[model samples]
Target: MNPRNILVTGGAGFIGASFTHYWLNKFKNDRIIVLDLLTYAGNMSNLSQCYENNRFEFIWGDIGNSDLVESILVKHSIDTIVHFAAESHVDRSILSPDAFIQTNINGTFSLLNAAKKVWIDTPKENNQPVIKHRFHHVSTDEVYGSLLPNEAAFTELTPYSPNSPYSASKAASDHLVRSYLHTYGLQVTTSNCSNNYGSFHFPEKLIPLVITNVLQNKSIPIYGDGKQIRDWLYVDDHALGIELVLNKGKVGETYNIGGNNEWTNIDIVKLICSQIDLKFAENSYLREKYPQAFAALSGDSASLVRFVTDRPGHDKRYAIDASKSESELNYRPTKTFEEGIVMTLDWYLTNDDWWQSIIDGSYLETNSKYMII
Candidate 1:
């Protein structure tokens, strides 16, 4: 296959960064231009290793900026766009829905509009072969909303029943992408993934939050009995899933990407706690730095678990049915929950400076030479 020039929005964020690394490592000749808004969740250090690669370029910008989006597309001769930028946290959306609406809804519209303008409406280079451009949208399973205890997992045909402002915004964005594909004939594919956990994950999310709280000796907040269930997908597996979709998925189709590993909120916390306890037991040096951690003492890490009032409009459960992607794209998640959790725990334990900087608000002060568009 010929090398493709790809534009990746939100490539500095967790899942996007993972996809960026996966793509660059696998497709060495392809060039990638990352466009991110550098919001609180966007960590430049996540892509620090990519700086040395001549094929990779980082641009500090927003997907909502149509002019910048168009400029990058035309300038780089981009043939593929992997859209991942959005306001993703449910708690933050409940407190402030405006950012969610603007970023998730309007921002997606801007990207679609810019792609249509440049890739479809504009004139192509003289004597050049027709380039097939693709627009891949990364979405979350929350758009399917809560499921009853025995309800089947969400499929591609699942009717969206978004409960929170965050999910509503994402649902709307998903619709916008679909419209562009049907209305303007833009090549588009969407993947709705289960909860992703791995390195460079913002500490605000559940997995990272629990891991960091344990390391810091802080209370691990479990909302409203903590029975909320989510299917966990390792970030790398999600990246691989996207790669399959981009390479083989049909145009104008949506695929569900899941790990098929489901666990309740409280259960997840307990698992992390036990893992940390084992880590502390095996490594004596951890006790010195995290002296106050529950495991560092002779106490169960579960002792730090605290039950907090649940957020408004909390979804009771979310599970994905990735059979469509599995059969059609021949995709499957390689990491089991056990292997993924162990890897995630080791990442947090070893990379103190990474998460520590985020906790102390030092990661935001990124003094770098990456171009800011």
Candidate 2:
């Protein structure tokens, strides 16, 4: 297996796509094989720009497909893997945990099993090995459960106490990844990160939802008092951190990546509103026209934010103690919350098609009952 060949699972989604794009641009010498099932959230439209690149290859497949996983690994001579495929939304996981279990739990084990066969069977380098491969698990901070308002953020030593089905599922995946390293002696590392908000993000998340809602003059919904606090990390910076960890991290260790940008849910919504007003003032003609189908698609401004019921088991605060990754891997977010928020709003405005289709398709599936929980 060649070191230059790497597999990035779920590369069509938000963070995965961003990371794939970044690597495609920066590491022209390396190749990435992206495997995504193209679930409602995974769309080829996002990666259309990278289709022509020889270093990047997109495969429509599930991580749990053992045959497909083994075939891709052997065919590509892949020696590295960045596992990013998972059902990540806390609210969605609350409604149905089955998808999370299948994708996040079973899917990861399938990959690990394939890797064990490939790595163990390969020739070893005297004391080292012929194929130097690594499995990097991308994870979330929610696995640590909620933090009290005045309590310290989640650090590496924080014990596992996941609240929602989503976090529990992720916590389970994290454990499996770690266990593979210890029990199987497979080369693995894990990173738990803060909330990532940036371009190409799904509308189910907060920042994009707020930006898109305000763009349509819809009321920005806030849960409870909207006082829940979260540490926001720009996806780009998080990508950089992950890349660094993949290349330079100690096997079996876990690193926490965050933006150091913390904000209450309400404050973020208001900030987005202010940015929207500025955008409208700068471009009055588009402002007069607004986005196409704004009235028919979403709704009026106040209707935008209808807080019917709070999501079950919502966490109060989630602040990442990202110093471990920062001090160890030289990772830090260059964009502050203000800058990242503005950039996100601008991206959404410029690339409405990317998100509009997501909302449209999501609306169509709104009637489908949740699978399991």
Best by TM-score: 1
After TM-score superposition, the amount by which residue 89's alpha carbon in candidate 2 deviates from its true location, in angstroms, is: 1.2
Q: Residue-wise lDDT of candidate 2 within 323-344, one digit each (tens)?
A: 8887888887888888888888
Worst 10 residues of 2 by lDDT: 364-373
- The positional error of residue 3 in candidate 1, measured at the CA in angstroms, is 0.8
Per-residue lDDT of model 1, residues 1-373, tens digit only: 8899999999999988988999999998999999998888889999999999999999988888899999999999999999999989999999999999999999999999999888887644454533579999999999999998799999999999999999999999999999998898889999999999999999999999999998888899999999999999999999999999988999999999999999999999999999888888878888877887865356478888999998888899999999999999999899999999999999998898999999998887782445355
Q: How accurate is candidate 1 locally (lDDT)?
A: 0.91
Question: How many pairs of residues in model 1 come into backbone collision?
Answer: 0
Q: List where candidate 1 sits over 4 angstroms from the true fold.
A: 124-130, 367-371
| Per-candidate clashes, comma-separated | 0, 4
Highest-scoring model, lDDT: 1
